[model samples]
Target: MAPDQTNSADVLIAPAPGPGALRHRLEEAILGDIASGRLAPGTALPPSRTLADALGISRWVVTEAYGHLVGKGVLEARTGSATRVAAVAPVAVPDGAARRVAPAPRLERAPDRATHDLAPGVPDLRHVPRDAWLRAAREALAGATNQDLGAQPPAGHPAARAAVATHLRRSRIVSGPDDAVVLTRGAADGMSRIAAALATAGHTHLLVEDPSWAALRDAAAAAGLTPVPVPVDDAGISPGRLRAEAARTGARAALLTPAHQFPLGAALPDERRAALLDWAREVDGLLIEDDYDAEFRYDRRPVPALQGLDPDRVLLLGSTSKTLAPAFGIGWMVVPQRWRAPVLDVSVRRGPAPGPATLDQLTLARFVGDGAYARYLRAARARYARRRAALLTALERELPGARIGGIAAGMHVTVDLAGVRVGPAGAGGDDAAVVDGRDGVDAAAADFAALDAAAVVREGAARDVALVDLRRYQAAPSARSTVLVVGYGNLADARLPAAIRGLRAAVEAASAEAAGAGAGAARAGPTGAAAGSVG
Candidate 1:
């Protein structure tokens, strides 16, 4: 058998080589072509003689390149057969295209393999009511009609919306008709939809809490709305600051977590809630309330949804992510009548409705309607209460000087390190500057001047105890104090004692080092000279 004649027009287009041996360059060119899909699998290559002649290189160069590629299984060369491309080739990924094709950026870090995981924003997934969920799913499938199985309206199934409305009215005092509700995949999805509507309505800016949920802030940015940060104190976001920010930025929309604020954990007081409502009405602005984890208050009664005060101006968002399980993918947005049409239009424009499956939505409807949801919450609340108590007891014993902020409602508590002396007395009052956006803000720099929360996180990790620094959630740095948002929901009761002990060791080590540095600085005056020395 004779080798096929190499046609010039059919020759593989190898990229021009630079600064390498001839054989190596040829090998790289061939591999590059295969990786870029220019050389399709099973496609025959030109004879070594023909390629060498065309490229004005020695035939040995081409032969060596082919031999090298064959060794790597990138090309198949059988005796008496053409050297064709291999059947399985490397996937083609153009330069700078990996970011575009990467999965959605994780809002939070992946859970560590630490024995004690105090990562915030995660619920106790072990407690998921599998039996109840299976029952609800079976009932949903059994009763689903032809219409129910079909594509539902972008707003959601009528029954699912009504069930959600009823749950809100009964549990959170948020009164609204069924039509006012819009189902979503989660609270993050709801925020994205609302942000789209606001952007479409010619709104350019969104007011967000300084140290708020990074996911919701990203959602607003993804919809082309700039998020303006308003500082949050112990009592959540201040209405006065919010109003002033709204006036300054001309932002007509604000995303808040009034019912147990994220990370900080402050439930907005009634007067502040009313003031916020007044601000919304006065500016004709919209308030996006993220009602995450409001059902697990351990100390006192759960704060009612802020939407209850002024449903027309406030958009209430809630999800089963915390109450049931994030796997449920069930969330609701009680849209004000004025914003419903625009939000629905944005949802439709974004392609299929942003929600769970029809069957899943129906299952949720049945789950909420049959009172199983309430019963589950009661059990979860009790379990979480016990966990919270154990955590509080341990924190008190281990970190006695640390001030815990936020309400006792949510799954996490904020450990304020400002009061815990990392340096000499009166050496930690310097305020850090705030920056816009969520990423690349250094916790060590943006947190309280004298304490390094990042150091604590590192030391904690070394002790096999996971920790999250609060500055990670800040859209803008807080000047108040450094905080650790420690979540106890996912941490098992048995692990609490050891976890606190390990955490305490880390804090002590980091604090001692910081204090030493502070003392050295004090001994050596401001100009790095010996104290009381003249230049």
Candidate 2:
């Protein structure tokens, strides 16, 4: 057992030969070392030639073993870097042990510190416009008046509101007076205020998109409003379904990501928009529009803000979480004139406004007014476009059968693994379970065994690739698809191929595990079977 020569500091013990093909033995030994934590995640391995020479084996044997492990995502190799153990590895389980389900991942938590994180809603922090931001901060501080440093109005500083109003009008086609703009810490903060206002207005039920961003649901619940999930589809939330849900649940307020629906990524068409507006007007309901990442649309010009169609019924929310960085802590809501006082009152009751410091708000005002923000967006769009292209290419090569959704725009895409036919009883077969009219898929129709999303997530995590199961966002179990919301915003273009390959390995493993489980269930008698039969 000698240390590797390439990186003299890191040690590598030569694996002993066993009774099998040299390559098989070598592969097994390496896997054993990795499983035993002797070759820890990210530990560099000796060059194949060095290991082969030291072990008195053919160099080809070592190379084949290393290649096999790389294909399995147990290791990673870069052109200019040494072959090393993957950043994430599967936890070792005893023989005959059952696999445990992983807990659903949260959207607000920062992604795990991993080699590749594909968690939805994470933005690329590397490209933040430091220079322009610093310039704006300096100008804001230099021009600050004593009043600017004092307690500010609940509606935000006049200059900042004016700047935001102008930007929304020019960019999102959301027209409103500066007074309509109410600043808050971020979209989450704005949502809280809106929820409180809805609660105060005697609204007990709020209509929400099924499989929507989880934070909005949390906000509505915190305000003592029950959230009733309305199904979404390829054309965005169906107006008919929403109307029906609202009528049944007596929900008078709804939150939507109409520009591009979060997770599933469907832009609401003009027709659906009109219908939704009509429904809102008929019910005298309120609509909260979260325009979280509208600025990053690559396929075409971004969809116009839903609020622009009828500002009186739509409270448009925008945040710098995506375009800039979450650390900026700035967001705005274009409130309806009638509800402005109620929202502000709720803000006051909650104590002092929880918005960013006045100086930071003023700096954003300057940033937007000086044309710096536009230039930054131009650069960011191109950067993200390239990263997105890389991710799509990798998925095409690695997982050809994966049905990709939400690729037209947004920070993430939905990968439907259940659409992939793995065997005779594979998903999307005649027996495929479908959710009734939910996202245009049958929920109870699957005849095949359900693929465990937890298994897929666990496998991806083992390879140091963070993934979010789409089921995490669902208010109810409505479908059998093991869909994953894969975010590429935080991932580097250079790493996409390896990350996707690792994900492919995870999907294949999960598919095989599911097929095996299905077979076992078929063989089991009624007495041997589990009590519950999930569709």
Each candidate: RMSD = 18.2, 12.4
Q: Indicate which candidate wins on TM-score.
A: 2
| Model 2: per-residue Cα lDDT at residue 346 | 82
lDDT of 2 by residue, 1-535 (tens): 3323345123434443324576776666677676666677777887876665344456798889889889888888898778887888553432211111122465766644566778878777655777689899999999999989889778888999999999999999997799999999999899999998888889999899997988888988998899999999988898889888888989988999999898799898899989889888998888899999988899898889999999999999989998887888899999999999998898787666557788999999999999999998887788778778888887766665677898468788988775453322323345432221222222222233456677889988898988888888899864554788999877755456678877877776676665556546555534566446443
| Model 2 lDDT-worst window of ten | 94-103
Minimum summed lDDT over a 10-residue window in model 1 is located at 432-441
TM-score for all models, in order of appearance: 0.71, 0.74
Estimate, for each residue in 1-535, the C-alpha lDDT of model 1 and write its tens digit: 2333544235543333345576876676676666655667777888887666434457788898889878878788999877877788554443322322333555574633466788787787656777688899999999999988877689888889999999899989997898999999999999999998999899999999988899999999999999999998888999889888888989988999898888788888888988888888888999999999998898877888888888899999989998876778889899999999999998788676557788888998999999999998988888789878888887876665578877778899988765553222212223211121111223332222255777789889988889998888987655533579999877766567778877777776666555446556666766789877878
In model 2, which runs have C-alpha deviations exceeding 4 angstroms?
1-112, 419-450, 519-526, 529-535
Q: Give the CA lDDT, 0 to 100, for residue 378 in model 2.
A: 84
TM value for model 1: 0.71
Error of 1 at 40 (Å): 58
C-alpha RMSD between model 2 and the true structure: 12.4
